[model samples]
Structure formats: structure tokens, C-alpha cells
Target: MLLNLLLLQCRAGFESECAAEFMQHCVDVGQSGFPRFDAQSGFVLFELYGDALAVIQAVSFRSLIFTRQWCACLPPFEQLPADDRLSVLLPAMTELPVCAELLAEVPDTTAGRELLPFAGKLASAMAQRLRQQGVMLPRKARADWRMHLFVLSGRHLLLGVSPRRNGSTLEMGIRRLKFPGAAPSRSTLKLEEAWHWFVPRAEWDARLGGGKTAVDLGAAPGGWTWQLVRQGMFVSAVDNGPMAESLMETGQVTHHREDAFGFAPGKPVDWMVCDVADKPARVAELMLQWALQGWCQEMIFNLKLPMKKRYQAVQQCLEEIAEGLEAAGIRFQLSARHLYHDREEITCHLDLRVS
Candidate 1:
């Protein structure tokens, strides 16, 4: 029997975890699929017997912890002439529905790094040719489809389409949020990526703008706290370690030398961010407590996973959090992802829905 395919990109070494999560999601939605993945390949393919669109619709990308980006798959082109690849690719382009943009990507692996320049050049050339041929829609056009070319090598690729409403907003599932040179640690990218993945940019002003207050648990060196302050939020930075002097100089942060778990805000704050190196369960409990007790209206935290049973561990932690929140009668929106910037950990965002 014929089966539809879905392509998912993820961090290398976690392909099994990603496949496990995808398979579980399919089972949860009553879709039957088997995932094909190899260790450290940085991508997974799911062959589904059911309607692919139905499965994609049932699973929101934001709720997926292991997947970085995904798309409905097309037949792989195994042989294209190196000198004139576009000639072969153009026919396929003509057959596809009009796409708003064309994105060329390579796997996130050592060997893939060598093809980055070629992939970018190819994408540029393809965009020009496809536009000239009217195969690609205009930039301002109201097109829903995005064309993606996953570069396997200079002469081969896996082509796919991702619908804008359900797929990643950025091309190739990569979030290119620039690193702030001023931020204290590289960990800043973790929170930045979480915001872009979980929160809509149009709603940033309303949800994370200035004059709001936040608490940064384990805020030493202030990576997460830097993000809060950058949003113009007054931050209570909780940690015993020294923070970045530049951040402290901003006068927007108040340091609390106390354990993040034991500390309580004088009143509810707009946001709470944590990057404490701790067990996933402990972090989940802290998140549930803050949300249930109304200590913070929103939170972004990290859950460091174990080397073995990573998927199971993540589910157990999330289930615990859900049960606690549900039992407390707290209305909340929770989303989790194993971000591109995260290693052995997943970022989670929780918003306490106000009645």
C-alpha cells in the first residue's frame, strides 16, 4: 500500500527521541505511522497510512519537544547533474503548487557543514529562476505553501512543502535569532528561541513589553534575566552567584541570594524564567507550584534529561506537571520543545490563562 511521508529535522544524537515523540503523537491522534531514522542523522521520516494532513493538523509543532521543524515530504531526487542541477529541479518545481518562498537547507551534521555555501547559492539561484518562470509566488502574495529543499549533497536533496499555518515560520525550521553580544552567557539563546517558538511575535508588545515585572530563578550570570530586562521588565534575579556587572548596572535587576525553590515573590509577577541545572522532575514541580500558587503568570524553564529513556523521562515530567496544574484548577497553556540551542534539555513555556 502507498503511504504518505513526513520529514522532520532535529538535533543530531536525538533522532531516536524525536522519532519516539513523533510516533507517540501519531498514536495519540489515532494515526498509524512508522518512523525511519538513523543515529546522528539529524532528521526523521514518518510513513503514515492515514491522511498526512490530518496528522499534521492534530499535532501542533509547538507541543513537540524533540522536533525542530517538519514538512510534508516529496520524492527524493537522488541524481541531479552537478553543473546544471536547476534544469532537473525545475520540472519538479513546475509540478508543485505555488510557494511563497523557497528554502534550501542541509542537515545539522559535520559533513553537512561542507555543503552550506553550496546550498545557499543553490537556493538563491532557484529563487530567481522559479520567480522568473512564475513557479514561485511573489513575496507579498498570500500564498500558504513554502518550498523546502533539504540538501543531502551537491547533487541530491529531499524536497518538501510546509503549510505556513502549521509549519515553521522561518525557512528550513531554523530560527535565526541573532546572539546578543552583550548577554552574559550563550544560554541567552535558549530563552530567545523559546519565545520565538512558543509566542507570536505580533503579541510580544502586549505580552512581554516594558513596565512588567519578572523573577529569574537561578539567575547567576543573568542569561535569562538579561532577556527579561531587555523586554523592560523589572527582574528579581534569584541566585547566590555573582551576576554580570553590566546587567546589574542596568538597575533593572534586584538580586536575591536564595534558593529558587524556596524563594517567593512579594506578589505575582508577569514572568518567571529558570535555567537551573536540576532534575527534570524538580524543575517541573517548581513550574507547577509557581503557576498554581499564582506566583507568576508566565514561565519559561529548561528540563535537563537523562542519557537513557530521554523520551520517557520528558513525558513523565510533563504528565506530572499537567496533573498538578489540572488538580489545582489552573487554566494554562503549556508548550515544550527540544530547541536547536538546547543540549540534553528541552525548553518549556507555560502561560497561566487569566479568566
Candidate 2:
């Protein structure tokens, strides 16, 4: 069969949560599986007792919070002779569905980082072989499945398949970004990445235009505020601490020395961004209040998770926000992610679809 197992990738040390999510997905799809994973391994293998096409078709990648990337896989090709790795891998892929692209991926771990160079070489060689063998087709339409090779070592690897649009676009489900020197803090990257994931790139110019207004709660030394300034939007930076003078000098920011929970924008703003270090529920509640009261059109914020039941925490917070918004007759779009830049917290983006 083409697929009997699944390979899932996530941040290192988040394997248990990822596994729990995958297990629940299988149940949701009416399939059964026993998850195999080691905590902090950065990957999981859900060994389905039968085929996996049902779960693959039923679950959407964006709906999963902990899993970064996933593929329906056949059993691995282990213990291949070191010298001729491609010889074994090529024949295995021959019987699978049509594939136009091959992604060479590794776990997000110390050892996996070291194998990157080797994975690249193997992918290059395999791509040529696949083309020559007529297994790889020209992707005229964007509908083809992308083959994934989860390389654990030069000799041991698991092969899998994922639909192009249904899975993450980045290789191994990780986005690598260089921090800007002028940004006030590394936290700036969190909001920036959330923008890329939530706001479509083409719509950025329209939605994030200059002259638009924004509010940054808990803004201090202004990390999130810096991004708004760069967008050419005026910012009401709410916090008691001092802000970066360089940002203040730009005339784009008005620093408000006050508590975020107690602070209210004098008028509705274009965007609301928060990174307050509080309970996940509280942060989520603050966002709900802003949306319900018609204070901001869009928002991006973080939820600091607890030591245990992290998945449950994220779900409860998001659900509460959705319930509050819907009950109050507000229509909106909401999404969250355990972004590449986030640590012990998940980032969320909410847009009140008010004209």
C-alpha cells in the first residue's frame, strides 16, 4: 500500500503535544492508530493499523496547532547500504502516486541540522533520477502531491506524500528569517511572521497600508510598535515603561503610559497587537473585549501557555474568543499558530470582517 503510517514534524520538545493532536485527528476521522514518539525528538510516527488516506483527506493542516508538517507514509526503508542509497529509495517511490516535487526534510533538532547538507545532495540526485524514470511530472496545475523524504540518517529515512496546498509550503515546516538590526527586540519577529502566515502577501499593501492606525498594548521599549511604525501607521503604544527613543523620534508613535487592560483606544484603530505576559485566558479575554467593543479591526497577540495541558489551554482560549465574538453578532476570521519565533506560547491573529 502507498500509505500505512504518518510522519509529523514539530518544534523540538513539543512531540507529546503534537502526538496528542495527531491521535485526536485520527479519532476525529474515525481511523485508529498508535502513536510512536519520544518527547523532544521533534517528530512523530502514528502507526495506523490500516490505510491512512482517510485521515489525510479529512484533516486540514491549518486546523492543527501543534503539527507543523505532516505526510501519509508507507513503512520506512531502513538499513540501506550506505554507498547506494538512491538505488533503494528510487524503486520505492516508483509505485506511489504521481509527484512533481520532492522535499528533503529533517527533524528540528541538533542532529537533524547537521544532516542538512547530505539531505540536499540526496534530493538533487533523487530529483534527476525521478525525472529520468518518468515518475515526476511537470506541475502545470498546482495540484500535484509533493513527496517528502524525512531523513533521519544517510541510510535510514521515511518516505511520504502530502498534497501541495494542504500542507505547509516551507520545507520541514520551518521558516528561517533574519532579524532586522533596527528592530527593538527579537519579539518583533513573532508579529512579523504572524503577519506572513495570517495576512496573504498580496493583500498586505491593501490591508496594512500607511496612514492606518494601530494600538500596541503592553508596548515597552517597543518591539511590536516598531513593526507598525515600519508599516507607516501611527501607533498608540500603551505601557508604563520607556519606549525606544529612535521609534518615538519617527513621530509615528504616541507612547501612552498606562495599563493595557485598563487602557482603551479613544477611537477604533486599524489593528491591535499584544504580547502581554499573562495567563493565556486573560490575554485571549482582552482580545475578545477589544473586538466585542469595536475597538480594533484586526489583532495579533500571544498566549503564554501553562506547564501542562498546553493544547487544552490553546483550545479553550480560542474557543472562548470565537464564542464571544459570534454571540455579540460580530463576524470575524481567527487563526493561531505555534510559530517558529514563539517560545512557550502561541501567536493568534483575529480580523473583524467589518467593512
Candidate 3:
């Protein structure tokens, strides 16, 4: 029996966690698969014995916390001649069905970085050749599939495909979000990336723009608060530490010298964002409280995980939140991911919507 493959990209040091999560997901869906990974390699491969595409379809990308991006795999080509790597790759590209776009990527490691320029150049050449061969669809056509070329080195490559509906929106599974210099803290990138992942750019105005009131817990130096202010929303920055004076002067922000866990607003706000340093369970409970109490319609927070059994910790916290929300008769959508900018923690987004 032939097996199919799923390729996943994750943080370099957390390949084991990513592999463990992938295996658990496969088991949860009643699929049989085994994971292949190396610590600090920044990738995982799950080979499924049954209908691999069906298994991939059943798994939601948002639920896989340790994974940054993923794609379905085709047979890999090993040790091509240095002089004509494209010639070796072309046959494989032609064998596949139509693809909307081609993403040329390397592993997220020093070795991978060294091959980036080569991958970029190869991707460009492949796109042109695929178009000429009528193997690539036009931009305006419905994108059924995305081709992924993972360059192991100048001489070796792994080919994969992801259905448009289930794959990363970006070519390489990396969202290249720019960091604004004006933001008071680098941590601001976390919220910015979360919004990009959870909310569509077109819906930003209706869902998170002007007239929306937000509370930023642990808002000292105003990293998260700065994002809110930029959206033209009024923010109550809560913390014992001083916020960025520039952010405070914007007059769009009001600083509250108080504890985040104990603070509550005079009235319910549109959004609540937290980045406080606390135990993962404690942070999860805080998030559940705000949602259950109807303090905010939406929330985005971080959970700092323990050194051991990190995946189990996140799962337990999420289960607890679900039970609390269900008991409170609240309708909500919760999703979490270990963002590229994150270290030793994961970011979660919850939407407390009226049923």
C-alpha cells in the first residue's frame, strides 16, 4: 500500500512538539500515521497509510499550536546535478496537476538561509516554465492548488502541494508582517500578527476600527495598546508600570495603574487583549472570566507554557475554557498558534459572538 505525506514547518527547537501534535491529530481523526522529525531541523513529515488528503482535510490549521505552516507532500528528489537542478525538478512539476502558484522555500535554519536566493530564483524560473507549458493557471482563475518546493540544499529538494482552501495564504507559509518603528515595544508584532491570522484585512474596519473600545491588560510600555490606538479605538491601558509617554499623549489611551487580573471596566468594551506574564492556566482562566462575564466581544491573549508537557498544558487550558464558556451559555470561537515571534509561549484568539 502507498502512503501519502504531510510536510510541516515549525520553530527550529520545537520540532518534537510539532511532531507529537501531528500524531495526536491523526489519532484523534482515526487516521493511522507516523511522524518524521529531527530536533532543531524546523520541519516535520507525517506519512499516512490511508487517504492522506482526507486526513489533512480533517485537521484544522489553527488547532495545531506548534506548527507554523504545512503542505501535502509529493515524492522528493535527491542529489540533483549542480549544473542543472531545474532540469531534475521540471519533470516532477510537470507530473503534478495545475497549480495556482509556486512557493520556493528553504528550511528555517542557517543552512536553509544559505539556499534562499537559489530557491527564489528557481521559483521564478519554474513559474515561467510552468506557464509556458500550461501547467500553471492564470491569476484570475480559481486557485485549486499551491505548489511548494522545499529546498533542502542546492542539489536536493522536496516537493509538495496544499489545497488552496486549507493551505497558508502566503507562498512560504510565512506572513511577512512589517514591524512599525513607532510601536513602543517589539512585542507589538504579536498582536499585529494575530490580527492578520484571525481577522481578514477587509473586515478590520467593521470588526476592529474606530469607535471600538479596548482594554489592554499589562499594557506597560503600551505594545499591545499602541496597536489599538492605531486602529483609532479608545484604549484603557492597565498596568502598574508606566506606559510609553508618546502613546499616552496620543489622548486615545488612558492609563490605569492597577492589576490586570483584578481590573474590570466601568462598562463592557468591544475588545480585550492581554500579554501579562503568568502561569498558562491562570491566563486561560482570566480569559474565560472575561468571555463568560461578557466584558468584551473579543479577546487575544498569550499563555506562557511550562517546560514539560507543554502541548498537554495548552490542551487542558483550552478544554477548561471551552467548558466554562459552554456552561455560561456563551457562543465563542477559540484558536491558538505559536507565532514566529513567540518564545516559550503561544498566542490565542477568542471571539465571543452572540449565537
Candidate 4:
């Protein structure tokens, strides 16, 4: 596609935050664009007044926190006849640069879920049509671009393009997981998703395994701790509350009856993970303190977002952390995301070792 606009997917009810962030980023990159989005549309479109190819090249998709998925797009096609929709969809699909992959996606809303059956059928029909048109490569055939068909309803859809390595490979930018029956609480899934998102699989054994040591602050009932233990890492589970007995019997966890905010590891450990429910500023500061003291080489924590000015809160916390690290001459890699398993807060991963 000779794309001129950007379609950004985000969590429903967060369209404003996504729009605000996207606008600021585009401004930073010197790209001018005006945004359009409904209150709960689960998407924001920045119709570019400047060149879109220039804009996407300047603004890395990973730099966006609020946005789940991004694609440079042609304007949406609407009101296709219920029958023979492929005839209408194929023309736009064929005009695109041949993409290595195709994703038929829907908004993460109740209405979108109802169209899942239709989405599947649409994907199959479009793939066959595009194949005949010589516009799409077979799946995983090695190409830089990805094609996305985002469906609003049976009769409406948008065609977009994204760099394969720059954004999520998953459809709809969602990482769905089955909750473990043995896990103590549903909160475990957040940390599990964190590892899945932040860590590349090839480095998992080297960075995440080998009987490494970890500390889980606010680890009562053992949600985050279970993931560490599952990876063969022994954990010092720190919380004032009682832990799940099933985890205790594994002989892998040492439960400490102490306040997480007040506790420190005896020595620097391989990892420190916290899921304490507290103010975002306090949480960011607490994580930084561990970094300054070299208490842990890596840390993952959640910042509970305030109800208002949520985007401002996120930027301030991240900026403070970045400035503190720079002033201390500490080299680090820091990133935050609003993950699928999270609500009202975002997860952060901070590594003291940049490489």
C-alpha cells in the first residue's frame, strides 16, 4: 500500500490516551498529523498531513507505550455488500507491496468478538484471492512487510501495512494465555506475559535460567513467584501476608514476613520482580533505588496508573528514571507497556546491563 495514514490499535476506553501519545511522538519526530477516534473505538487514526513513510521511518513503533499495534494504512472501505465482499476487498489488497503475512483482525470489544467467525472466513478468502493476484507471499516466506485487514463489522474494513520486526506479530496485538489451575492467583499471568513480551526466546536459557536467584516483593499467595520458580530459580518471597502453602512445600521459596518497600536483598540477585499496588511515582522510585545500589541486574514491576492524566504520569515516571540513571552514569535499558493481562496500570522492565 502507498500508505498516507496510520492506524493505531489500543485498549478500548483508552483511545484518548493513545491519541495523545501518538500526537506527541509525531510532533517529536517532526511529522504533522491530526487524529480521529471515537471514545471507545479501540483505535486512533493519525491522518498524516506530512509524508507517512517519512514519519514511520522516524518514529519507531516500539517507542509507543499506549499503542498495541500500528500500521500505515489506506482509508477504510465501508458498506460492502454482505455477499461477494471479496470482490471489493481484493482490489485494495492487491495494490499493496507483497507482504509475508496476513492478519485478519478485529477490535478488542464485545461486538468484535461476535465477528470472529466472519473474520476467519474473510482471512481465507482474501489469502486465496491475493495469492492469485500475486500480491502476497506465503506465510513466513521472509519479507519485511505485514498486511493487516482490520474489521469493524462484516461490511467495513481497513487495509494497513507494518514492518514485520517493528511491531507485534500476533493478531490484534493481544497475547492470550490460559490461567494455570495450580497458580495461586490470576495476577501470575501478568508476570508470565511480561517475560513473554520483554524477553526474546533465544536468550531465555542464558538470561532466565540456570538456577538463578530472584526476589518477589509483595509475593503473598505466590503469583509472580511461581513464574520464577517455574524457571528453576529460587526465590525469596517477601510479603507480610501468608504465602500459598503449595508453593512453600516446593522447597524453592523462602518467605520473608517483611514490608516489600522496606526489604533489601542480602546481595545482588539475578532478578527482582515486584507487583506491589502503590502510587506510580513511589513504585518507579523504589525500582530505581534497587538499580542504584546494584541490588539486582534485572527488575520487572507494575506502576498503578492514576485515574486522571494517566499519560502524563507515565512520562514523568519514565523520565525521572531515565534522568536518574544518566546522572549516576549507570547504563540501563528501560521499557514499559500496558499489557493484555494488566488493568489500570502498566508493567515495566528495567535492566541495569544495557547489552
Candidate 5:
């Protein structure tokens, strides 16, 4: 049976691109889904072919917004009441199963040009209508999550709600408003940005649940190590240097006071995480060796970039790493991005498996 599937893509510079890439990746994993076009919203729509909840969970966790683009699929459309259009589509849009009806539909209006009461009514009615259909997510049951709504041009209203940190309204406003004089802010930690960029917490937990272990190279201050330890996993933090007092206190982290290259785990670890201040090629080599030797099941590492040929460097590094891993007959999942947290660098995550 054809089913409606909505994909939530992230916005660039706001770490939304990562979400977008994941959505595209999901498209490639086509057994469970397929893509359709929603020219009305100016975003690609998807036709789900598997579990309704899986589609919702995947897109909800990926996109920063609670965006549900329109798509055409399945039967029983004629049976659905006109008011139930949005509700019928909600369950297929995310991992949640919600049945809602459109309370009202309002025409498009430009921002800063004075929105009519009907516009506000349209949004409010949509919310209330969903509540009536038991579509409202239980707030008391899930206190940690926050939701944001973005009304894009062309009457495209997308939602980006999550149960994570509530982004600052200033930051959100800056991104959405795009004020002319806004300078690119750099106060945000790059590694934190990379965490969200490379791996969402859900996927990270899934990897761990799948029995993934990890090695954190150059884990001095222990920022990255801290994250790993919190995940209830063992970490081999390699560095001749001392770890932060706080990380060492955790006891879950093992400090290998030696060159990361010279050291090897007694057995294969599930992951090898590197945040070293080394040349990109060298970092790539270390990652390749681990994959080629079957040292780890997956890897998330960083490559410090030079001033020149930034894109060229990334391409070259990817090629060399791919060739090396392929020569060793290792099949893997690999991704790289100019993470919001990275400066003059790009981070790579590789999931290596024997399949």
C-alpha cells in the first residue's frame, strides 16, 4: 500500500545540513521507502512502504524542525474526511502515529507585512485540531523536548521540534531573520557541533546497543572522551598527555599514555574516535589502518585542514582512505561534513562492517 512519508531536512550553517544528508541516506536505503515530489511546499516528499512509526522516528530525529511535507501515496484518501487530511498524514510523516484533521486553512501571507488574524487562527486551529485527533505529543510525558515552528515562503509551514536543548531565540531569530549585519558567531564549541553534525544521539545509542566499542585518540582535555564515557562504554583514550581531571575521575576512561599510532587494542573495538591536531593525511592513515586491520567496527574522527585547497584536500583524503579500505576488502559507511563546530577542518564518521 502506498503511504505518505515526510522528510525533515536540516538547514545549513545551523547544523541542518547533517539532518538533510541523513534524510538523503535514508532515501538510498530504499527497501523501506521511496521519494515523491511536493512542488507545493518546494520540498521533496516521500512515499513510505514499511512501518509507519519507523518513518516518523527517522525523520523526526533527523530534521531540527517538525516539518511534514505533503506527498501522494496509498489508498483510502477518498475515505479520509477533508478535515482529516493533515491528521492522516501526520503518522506517516514521523515515527509518531497521530490522526488529526485540519481545523482551517489560511492563505499565504508575507512576514513583516502584517499577518491577518486568520493566519494566526490557521496555526492555532491546526494545533487545536490535532489535539482533538489525539495528535498532540504528550508534553508532561516528554518534558525534555522543545518544538519550534518556521513558516517559510510560499506558504510552507514547517515545524522543527525536538526533545533536546532549546536553541536560543536569538540564534533562531538570527538564522531565520538573516539580519544584514549579523556576523558569523564562533563562540559555540566546535566539537559539540560536530557531535550533532556527525551522529545524532539516537544513532549513537543504536551503535552502542549493537556492541560498538571505541578508542578516543588525543583525548587530553577529554571533551570527546567525556561524551563517550557517558554513553556507558569503555574508551581507550590514547595520548602521552594527561586527561582532564574531570574525565580521569569518571573511571570509565582508560588513558593510554603513548603514541596513538604505536598502541593497539587487545581486541577489536567498535569505534575509533580521533580529534588530533595532525595533518589530514596522517589522520586518514590512522583511520585506514584501523579499518584495514579490522581494529574497530566504526570510527568518528577529525582532520585539521590547511589554508589552501580546502575542498581539494577533503576530496584527496577521501579518495586515499576509500582506496585503502577497499584494498583491504572492508565494507563501510562513511560520511564527512564541514561541521558547525569545526574550524578549518572536517569530521568523518565511518561505520565498518563485514557484510
Candidate 6:
């Protein structure tokens, strides 16, 4: 049986855009299914057919899960028809029992930090419920479920609702989580929310082929470098400043002690990660060089943004990068977005085909 699919992002202030792009991607990726934008109902719905659940599960395992959220929408939630059908689809509610009851009990009322906890509660409850239902969800289902949290209150509060079958009864619940009160005041080089980075790092580690050479630009405090080292990649950390004491001791991480712009590996690397907090255009240029010059086969990086015209700036950056790659006759696939953990910035994933 096919089910409707929906995707949600945790970052407050980014639902409509996230929903639009995510649904479009789902339409393309979902061969057994297609999206139905139910703006009237304020959610995107998909008509999924054979193996629809499997495809969603697959995408969610890959790049579909961002930050603390899962972008793939869980159906029946968006355009649900009745409560009885809901009962048949939900899980046991063991992992987060509070979620199963509380989510359904509370209306969207709170904001900010309180809301995210609500999301966590819901995820826990949903996992419990799914287990009871015998749905046999993938391991990632718990972590990525938050992406379905919708932004209804000026994008400040997030809400997520899902149902999993629990034998003859459907256990359903709703979850809400709040975003941070303010953006970072300084570039401390230490992540306030390391979990956000960790999840994506795990995803990257899984996708990376069994190669080990990596370069981490702007490697101070070593947050990004730490992940690379832990993945068993030999990392040349390039930064004029010192790395974190812990990461420096890892031994797998090499301190290049230089500027990222000027430093280059002796030979091509399997991966390059840049979180330099530089202008988007400059970052895009750097990525172009790395791709065109055969410096790296894959890259995961971030581009800081100007507050005004965020979309315009990002759009232009993508366009220019596309032109650059085209002019150089390089074959690549690139994706950029405002990550759930990001504030005034977006992460970019670029892969270049190498023979």
C-alpha cells in the first residue's frame, strides 16, 4: 500500500521554502509517488505506491535528514481523513510515551526552546509507537523524524505529527520544538549545537568511499576536523590559528598551520570540508577551484550569508558556481540549503565525477 509523504525542517523561519523544495524533490525522487501541494490544508501531501516507504526510508538515510530534522514528510499527517484510520497506522509509543499522548493533547501554543523539547518528546513517543506497530523502522527514523515539524507561528515554533501502525490500533502523536532565541554573536569556532553537525557527519561518513585523505579549512577548535579524524580520514587541518587541544591530540589530524586560501594538498584528496565563514561568492570560487583542479572528489562546506536578500544571494551563488563548472567542463552535482542547525548560513554538498 502507498502512503502520503511529507518533509519538515527544524529551523524556525524556513518552513515554506523547505516544504516547497522538499516536496518538489520528492516528486522527482518518488517514482511510485508524486506530491500534492495542499496549501489549503497547509501541508504537502504525496500519493505513494509500491515501495514508497522504502524509497522515503532510503532518502531519509542519505541527504534527506538535515540537522535535527527529517525532511521527508510522513503521510496521513498532511491530509489526514479521519481518526480511526490514524489508529490503525501508529506505533506502540514506548520510546517516547509522553509524545504519544502529549502531542495529541497540546495545540500549537509555545515558542522557541520549549518547542524543540516538545519535538524531542514527540520523536521519542513516535519511536515507541512504531516499535509496537511492528513497522520495523530504520535506525535513522528516530533522529530524522523532526524534519516533519512544521513552522506555524511566524516560523518560530515547530510542530510534527506522525502515525505508525500499532497492531489493530493506530498510535499517533504530535511534537513541537523551538529554535534558539538569537543568532551567534561571535565566530567562536565552537559549535553551540554539535549534535546538528554530528548527524550530518555520520551521514557523510557513510557515503564516503573507503578513502582517507581530507582537508579541513578554517579548522580552529577542530569541530569539523574532529569528525573527519574520527571517520578514520587522514586530515590536514589548514588554519593560521591553533586547533582544539583535544583534536590536536587525535594524531589523525595534521596541523597545516597556514592560510586555507593558499594551502593545497600535495596530491588530490578524497574530500575537502570548508567552514571558513567567508562570503558565499568566495566560497563558491574556492569550491570551483577544488572541483576543476581535481583537488577533491567530494566536498561539504558552508557559506555565510548577508541578512538581506538571503535567497537572492544564494541563488546568485549557485548560478555562478554552475557557470564556473560548465565553463570548466566539469561534471558535478551540487545541493545547497539553509540547514536546521544553520543561522544566516547554508551548507553546500558538491560531488564531482572522477575517473
TM-score of each: 0.93, 0.96, 0.95, 0.97, 0.50, 0.55
Better of 1 and 6 by TM-score: 1
Question: What lDDT would each prediction earn against the true structure?
Answer: 0.84, 0.87, 0.85, 0.87, 0.53, 0.53
lDDT of 2 by residue, 258-339 (tens): 9999999989999999988899999899999999899988999999989999988888999999999889888988888889
Compared with the true structure, the alpha-carbon lDDT of candidate 2 equals 0.87
Comparing 4 and 6 on TM-score, the stronger one: 4
lDDT of 6 by residue, 1-355 (tens): 2334433323444334445455445556654554554322323344455443454554432343222233233333333223332243343222222222222221222433344554555445545655466543544344323223343222222233332221001111212223322212233232323223333545654545254889988877676776666567888989887887767676778888887888879999888888887888888888877887889978878888776666567778877887889898888777764543466687777778532
lDDT of 5 by residue, 119-141 (tens): 35545655665565566654344
Alpha carbon deviation, residue 340, candidate 5 (Å): 1.5
lDDT, candidate 1, 1-355, per-residue tens: 1227888889999989989889988998888888898899889989888866567767877668788778776667888899899888887767665787877788889997688888889988888898888888887787877778889897778777777777776655677778899999989999988888778889899999968999999899998999989999999999989999999999999999999889999999999999988888898998888888888888999999988999999899889998988888877887788887898898888888552
Identify the superior model by TM-score, candidate 1 or candidate 3.
Answer: 3
Candidate that beats the other on lDDT, 3 or 4, i.e. the better one: 4
- Which runs of model 2 end up more than 4 angstroms from their true locations? 138-143
Ranking 3 against 5 by lDDT, winner: 3
| CA error at residue 350 for candidate 4, angstroms | 0.4
Worst 10 residues of 1 by lDDT: 1-10
Q: Which runs in model 5 stand beyond 4 Å of their true positions?
A: 1-202, 209-212
Residue lDDT tens for model 3, 151-251: 89777788877777876877556777788999999999999989988888999999998679999998989989999999999999999999998998999
Ranking by TM-score: 4, 2, 3, 1, 6, 5
Q: Of the candidates shown, which would achieve the greatest TM-score relative to the real structure?
A: 4
**C-alpha root-mean-square deviation, candidate 3:** 1.7
